[model samples]
Target: MTGTGQALWRRVPLWGVDASLVALSLLDAWINLYGEASPFMWASAALGCAGLFLRRRLPLAAFLLTLPMLVFMDVAVAPMVALYTVAAHTRNRLLLAGCALLNAAASTLVWPMSDTLSGEDRTWTLIQFVYTLATAFAPVLFGQLVQARQDVARQLVEVEEAREHESALYAQTVLARERAQLAREMHDVVSHQVSLIAVQAGALQVAAKDPQTRDGARAIRTLSVNTLDELRHMVTLLRASGGRATELTPQPTLAELQQLIANSGIETTLAGELPPGISTTAQRTIYRTVQEALTNVRKHAPGARAEVRLWHDTQHFGVTITNTAPTRPSVPLPSAHHGLIGLRERAELLDGTLTAEPTRQGGFTIELRAPTHPS
Candidate 1:
């Protein structure tokens, strides 16, 4: 059948199908036993038709219920359906073969006993028995074929899903390789040139006689150093793409927090200290949060004074960075605006939270809170 037709057939209620099969079996019984006034024959036919309803739930018992009708009256519908149901639901080959033999015997031998048994009659009876046995196996084979078809379809679906998953992983692997290549170029070429520029500017600042030239050279050296710091962080992030947080290496810890604040170019004060024995991941998270916050203060709030406060309670440890409003006019700087987002992502990996908002005093505050022993 076509896919659409098969889907519609599956949507039909199961009870409705069972009821229809029962009605068909009853009709077959009536046609075979018409005009028979025997109450015993009618009862047997009624019982056989009723047994069809239980074929799916109780296949063996339902087939046994229809045996009497096969022996007394020639009825094939109910017995064949029950045998098919048994074959479809079970994988016991010996049981199915025994059922087929019983079905053939019950149908071939009628109820009435013949007093005179001739050799020709015996030969004819044997032929009929063989033919009946072959007929009984027809539904059994068909039911098994249907069961096998359903199994193959289910296996095909699983294979397709696995193929799609493999394809997705392959794509991610290719993208990560590209990002690694880009990071290598940035570190090898761009970082090397920037380091040389910083060195040249420092030498010029020392050798120059004019005050203005010395000041310009000093500014260039500081900017170059800041750019190199940002570049190193970017390279680390690119190298660790498509992996877990623990894969990130060469990460800064709380020990570097003092150096980070001093190099940030903003007037920043470190207020408190965290207890020792913290995990590397938590320390990195705290360090990144403070780094990003200080960077933001220097960029967007010029000449701002910032304070870094580190505190811990019994359960949690965190850092808060608050900066005063800009004292000088701020120059607009081009920004990708991903620093806060990266900090938040790192905090989440350590089961932490980060919040950045404007304070009522016309300044900005960035805070990070995390569990001391994160899993």
Candidate 2:
């Protein structure tokens, strides 16, 4: 029963096999008495046949019904069949062993003792008794072992499936966070530049001079190219898959400081060399801080002069941006933009510190420092 046909046979309920086995056992027992059919034999036959009905559901109960009949006659047909079913189906080892002992005891006690009974006859009887007991007991223990192995296999499969599900959930969470980070970067760069371009275009349209118009057009062209390049770079990164594609775009570096200053509408100055060996994350953070500061400058204090400085030692990369206060009597206060809060969060996430305070010269200064060494 190891192939596909065996698998199909296991599912089939062989009612006929159970019936035939019960009937043959009873017929042999009746004929062994060597007389006309007696009422006890008829009663035993009916009990044996009826007991098979409960074989699948209640094997132990059927076995108990046949136990008493075994004491009356050496040959009991239904008891052995019912005991075999019990040993195969039941999970109780103790109960199966007890049933086997009872059958052996009955077989020994029921065999007639007469002058004709020889020593060899008793020895052969004992051998057959041992063989019957072995048959009755072995199946139960084997069944238990098989069931245990199956249970362990099922539990292992469940554990593997749970691990895979957890891994999938973690992957989804990481992908979602990366997408949000990309969106924030795009919004920061595009929004700031577009606002500046709109203002310059409007100013150029109203100007009476040709030189100012040409300058405005040039600034507009520069901003447009910068926006297009950033967009293209982001799209390429998003489309990339493997390790090689990751290094395709030129990474942002401190060398881009001059371009960052040129893009500012407010008058700005850069001082000192940016440190080497700075992480890409730190560089981007520095750029975003400066960008947001300049955006706030244009919105809060027009025509303001700002100074940006990069200073680094063996331990830290430091950045500071400070703007002079407006000359007019009424200077606009900084708006409630979420960009400053976002910068602070970004700094904290990188294990860095950011501080912003009003300067003694009636201006605001923002400073940030991050450690280069990993702990």
Candidate 3:
């Protein structure tokens, strides 16, 4: 059947199908005994038709119940359906063969007290028994075929799912290879040039006679060095190629805060200290918040003097970075403000909050607040 048709067929209640089978069996019984009024025969036929309802739950018992009708009345529907139900549910070939033989015998033989076979009658009875046996086996074979078809369908679905999963894994491997190639290019070409620029800037800072030239060269060297550190981290991540987590380098934490401030090239003062034993993730969040704040100060609030303050109470722990007004005229630089957005996301991951706003004193302040021990 087509997929939609099969789905609709399945939606038909199982009990309804059983009821329909019982009705068909009863109709067969009525047609066979149209003129007869034997109470024993009628009662056996009724019992056999009712037994169809139990076919799903008790296939063997339902088949047994139909045998009396097959022996006493000339009816085929009830016994055939019961045999099919047994074949579909069970895998024992011996049991199915025995049931088929019993069905054939019940239909072919007369009650011993009613009739006796002899001569030509005996020979015909033998042929009729063989014919009835073959007919009884028909439903059993069809039921087994249906059972095998369903098993094959289930296996096909499982194979398709496995194939899709393998394709996804192959795609991820290809992506990781491309990322590794890109990392190699950046390390060889970009890092080499940046190192040269930093070296040249350092020499210029040492040799220049003018104070402004010396300060400018020093700033360039500092920025280059910081850029190189970040590039190194990126290269390490790419080379790991989605391997084990331990293959990645250690992340920045509170211990590195002082070095970050010194390398920032901003006239930044550090104050206060957080209590010990904070989680590594929380420390990293705090570190990134301060890093983004300092970078913004250097870019947007040029020549601003900044202060980094760490604070912790019984309930919370965080860092606040506040800067004074720019000492010189600020330059208009293109920014997508993604750094602040990332900082805010990091704060949220720790169930915390980040606030960045322009102070009334013509400066900016970025503050991070998080629980001391987040659950």
Model 3 spans > 4 angstroms off:
1-12, 35-37, 113-125, 202-218, 239-375
Q: Is candidate 1 or candidate 2 better by TM-score?
A: 1
The C-alpha RMSD in Å for every predicted model, in order, reads 20.7, 25.3, 22.6
Cα RMSD for predicted model 1: 20.7
Error of 1 at 274 (Å): 24
Number of clashes in model 1? 0
For residues 274-334, write the lDDT of model 1, one tens digit per residue: 7789876678778868876876776578668999999998888899999998865554554
Candidate 1 structure lDDT: 0.82
Q: What is the lDDT of residue 81 in candidate 2?
A: 71
Local error of candidate 3 at residue 46 (angstroms)? 2.0
TM-scores for every predicted model: 0.55, 0.40, 0.54
lDDT against the true structure, each candidate: 0.82, 0.66, 0.84
- Give the count of colliding residue pairs in each prediction: 0, 0, 0
